[model samples]
Target: MTKRIFRAVFLVSALALAVGLAFLMVVLYQFFGGQLETELKNEASYLSIAVENDGAKALEELPEHAERVTLISKDGDVLFDNRADASEMENHAEREEIREARERGYGQAVRTSNTLAEKTVYYALRLENGDVLRISSTQYTVAALLGGLLQPVLLVLIMVLILSGIFASRASKKIVKPLNELDLDDPEANETYDEVAPLLGKIRNQQRTIQQQLSAAKRQQQEFSIITENMSEGLLVIDKQTDLLSFNSSALRILGAKAAPQNQSVLTLNRSEPFRRTIDAVLAGGHRTELLQVQDGFCQLIANPVLRRGEVAGAVLLLVDVTERIQRENLRREFTANVSHELKTPLTSISGFAEIIQDGFVKQEDIKKFAGKIFDEAQRLIVLVGDVIKISQLDEGCLPYEEEEVDLFQAAGEILQRLHDPAQERGVSLHLEGGHIIHQTVKPILEEILYNLCENGIKYNREGGSVTVTVRRGEDGAEISVKDTGIGIPKPQQERIFERFYRVDKSHSKEVGGTGLGLSIVKHGAAYLGAGVSVHSEPGQGSEFILAWRGKK
Candidate 1:
């Protein structure tokens, strides 16, 4: 800005100086020319008077001067010349001054010399005797006049340039000082030139708008950070160059990264081959997913491509923990296979016995025995099917029952009565003890829980062993316990006993005559009623299954 100002000032000053010099030269030239012409006219009149008085001899009698004097005859012949030989001079009759003087009383003319370096001004007067008298003087041309003054003009121009440079620099600094000191942050508050006020107002408006936009952007960034930090699933964002842009705490934990991963390459976090391949595939405009065993558990990694204008810009990686889900799927497959095998055994027995009777392969006396075996197998199939249906309903949480206040003691008594025949067959004595402890729960679920527990106790007990049902009210809640002198569960298998078709003594499962879903039913039914079941047992001493419910106070 300062340089431009200085240049403008210097140029204007130099142009003004050049124009002034040219005008002075022209004015001086015209003034001097007029003065010289006037002097020639006066001299011509003076010489004419002298020659009129003294005849042609007056030219020779004139004192030596810078002016040239001449006399001409009426017939175009030079009579006398003061500066040159009159006899040898050319005729003056055809001269412009002589011709004009003959027409008028006096005439004047100016002419350049043959060499064109100088000019002469002539004034002619017609004397009374009909002779022409002329006076002439020499003057320099316009070029010669300027050449004589060249040194002085150059010296003055040089002085002007030096002074202009100094003034230009100082003026430029003065003009730019206000702008340099302007407070741009608060443009409207600055004290400066009125010509700059509108520009400053525009700058102030833009600054306010930019500040608002910056504040809004900062708020959004904070909100995003808060949300991602609190999320349960791992989230990571990367750019097209595979550099990590952002990541949540969950992502850091899932990847087991020991450092904050911002602005680092994705490979710096996890450089496993499979992980790299998945990221590469996603970044190439494709979506990829894989299950990875990371650290102590299983994670489902989903890499989705981010697109902008039909091109892949980056990728978003989502990691979901699916360890429990995987375990449940495996359990489901095993349950299905076990159920099929369990059902096929009884079905095959029934089919074989019935086919023998129908084919008449068995004698008449063996018919009753074959029919009885078929009936027993069919009954076992029905029991197995019913147990499966009950378990399915419990799992789906659609078992039909209503919540009500029911006495645990009474429910236990009813279950004991129903299992009397089974108890007699197993030679296991049954006893009910404890007060009438009232608990708020679904009645059917409570009954189902007690029946399965007592049944399991009787089925797995030795002959002449005892099964006891105890209902008691404690400070926490109502508890119903079924204790039996049965073959106790082994410590290692205790946790798995609640699973479907899991029998502690599988070799004697058939002789025990159970669908192998008794304890499973008890577990599910107790869970539905919001109760807890635990077993206190040791090998061969006995086992106690306790069901406790914490009723609302």
Candidate 2:
């Protein structure tokens, strides 16, 4: 601030000095060119009359002065001179002042003397006797005559310089004082300096706008911090340099990072093999999403630039813990592949058998078996296709339900009855015990949930495994459980088992003719009807799948 003030003062002083010097130059030119010319004019006119009356010889002999006098002919032939030989003088016939004296009685002109290399003024007058008088004065002679004027002009220049600097300082202060007043604490004090009130008002209004922007920025920062901190997935913000500017606790844990302190960079923060490539691209100003590996999981990074006034100030990198999102994406892709494969198997078998029959390749003795196999594949296709439709309809909220109150015991019995033949064929015992009359969404939708659960329970079972289906009432909603002595689910795959096309084992699930979508439909159905589902399972132990219907509220 002090430097800025001094700089402003210095600049004004320089301008003031320039202006003062220019004014002095003008004053000097005016004094010498105008006042001195008039003085010489009067002196030359008086001397001309003296020379005309008192002959050229008397004029030349009178003084031998450098303010010299000479006489010339009407044709500009020099006749007399005070200092130099008349014949040596240059021709003055072509001179305007000399020609004017011969024709118009008098004239004046200043020119450089060829002989002396000095400036001289010549005033010429026509004499009564028809000769011309030429009076000449060198510039030095005029300067000496105005010698007294030199001291005053020099003094004026000195005074101008000193006074200009003083006024410049005072004027600069007066102009800048308002700015100092603008820095005062009291907002009201800004108005007292009326000389700059409008400008101050504009500054205050702009300040208010800046404060508003700062407040909005702070809010966005706080919101971004909250999201990064509280999210289950990890997050990181990297700058254009790919240095870690900020990150949440989840990011640290995900990166397995031990080096990212408050001021440490991303490079400093346990930069393992995966993050290096992403950092490189970001630093190189690549605008794209880059995926990197951190620890054992996946990190999806998006690199973008922060622009200020149309230039890139830095980059912003958003790091997401796609460990789960990637898994979900892989699951969805796999699910589609599995569904395609499952549907194709039945179709392929049917098409092959049909082709054999059409081509007359199947022997008459074996045609019945081929027919039966074709029928079975067709039936499996129907079931698989129906399950797909059911799950998709549930997702789209298109599955219609009857909300009539149904006895939980009756519903459980009916679902178990549908599963009894399959259960008995597998040598699995089916047990149903119940005690509730719950008001819930029912009919076409509710019956399917029970059937799917019971079938899944028995189908996934070991031989002679018992499937206990229970229906009971709780404090608010009804409870139903399908406890199965099947091959239990692993801890990791448990969460995703209810998703579409998921199976514990594909070969075993195919042998059991499972569509892999029944549980997903069940989950979505329960959720749509405002119910809750939970699970309890161990790796070796049996699993319990429970659904609680929402009570009328």
Candidate 3:
């Protein structure tokens, strides 16, 4: 703006100077030309009187002068010339000034000299002797005058332009200074031009509206961040270009991303086939679910297209950890098969014994023995059915027992007493130790856990071995440990000992007459009662099972 203003002012000043110089030169030229013509007329009148009085002798007697004097006859003859030979001069009768003088007494004409930067002014008078006298003088034209004044005019123009530029620069700066220093952040607070007051007021209003919008956007972002950050499931948002737009920390963790993947290609987060395929399908406006292997576990990826105005705009992805669910499904299938086989064994035995009697294939004396065998198999079936029912109830969490304060030592004694006859039959000793520690728990569940552990100890122990039950108050909780001198489990198989229908020695399990669900029941019952059960064992040494519960606050 400053440069433009300077240029404009400078050019206008230079142009004005040029125009003024031209007008002054024209006026001066015309004024001087008129004065020179009047002088020529007077000189002609004096010369005409001289020529009339002295005839041709006046030309000879005249003093030296700048004006050219011409004498012409009425018959169109050049009589005498002051500056040139009379005989060589052109005929004067045809001259405009001479013709006018003959008809109108006196006449004058101004004509430019072709060979010089001047014009000739001629005055002619018709004498009473039928003769004409003419006086001519030269005057410089406006072009010559302007040429003489060129240097001074140029000097004045240069000074004017320089001053104009300086003034324009200062003016531009003064005009824009208030705008440059305005406080846009607080527009209304600035004291500037009133001509721009409306604009400043509008700016202030816009600032307020922009601030409100920014605040609202910030709050929404915080809310979204809170929701996503706290989620357990991984969530991801992407654009149609497959660029990662937003994602939660859970998404980063689930995808094993070490850095933020925002605004990058979704494939940069994960390059696995399932992940890529799911993203591709979703971006194509399809919903897809795929299983992705992440380290030692599995994750379920669900991708759905995000729609905007009935068009695919982007996609949303959800990641769920399904490792535990998959394991449960496998366990359920295995349990079903195990139950079928276990029930078939006892039912087959009972059917065989009864069929022998019904077919009359046994003697009368052996009939009682066959009935006894059938009864024993029936009893085994009953025990198996009862164990299955208990496990199912624990799995479904439908137990009717409620919480109560029970004597832990007393509970151990009661379980041992119930298993004492079996212990005696196996030639294993049963003992109860520790204090009468009272623990808060469900009595039925605790008793069930105790019975299963104690019975297993007796059933698996060697002859003359001892089965001891100890109850004590631990640092954080009540503890009950059932230790046994038995053919201990192998270290490698210890973890699986709590699984349903698992047996170290299948032949020994048959001889011991068990449903093979004792330890499984103990595990489930301990879990339902909010306790932890662990075991320590060596092959030849005794095995110990410990159940601990957190202390009441």
Q: How much lDDT does each candidate structure score?
A: 0.88, 0.76, 0.87
Which candidate number has the best lDDT? 1
> Where is model 2 poorest over a 10-residue stretch in terms of lDDT?
139-148
- TM per prediction: 0.65, 0.52, 0.74
Residue range 472-518, candidate 3, lDDT tens digits: 87788889999999999999899898898999888989888798899
TM-score of candidate 3 against the unseen true structure: 0.74
Which residue segments of model 2 deviate by more than 4 Å?
A: 1-260, 269-274, 277-286, 294-299, 307-313, 320-325, 361-366, 395-406, 424-429, 460-465, 474-477, 485-511, 527-532, 535-542, 549-553
**Candidate 1: which stretches are off by over 4 Å?**
35-89, 105-152, 208-239, 245-260, 267-327, 341-391, 402-553
For candidate 1, list the clashing residue pairs, or say none: none
**Candidate 2 TM-score over all chains jointly:** 0.52
Query: For model 1, what is the error of residue 312's alpha carbon versus the real structure, in angstroms, after optimal superposition?
Result: 4.4
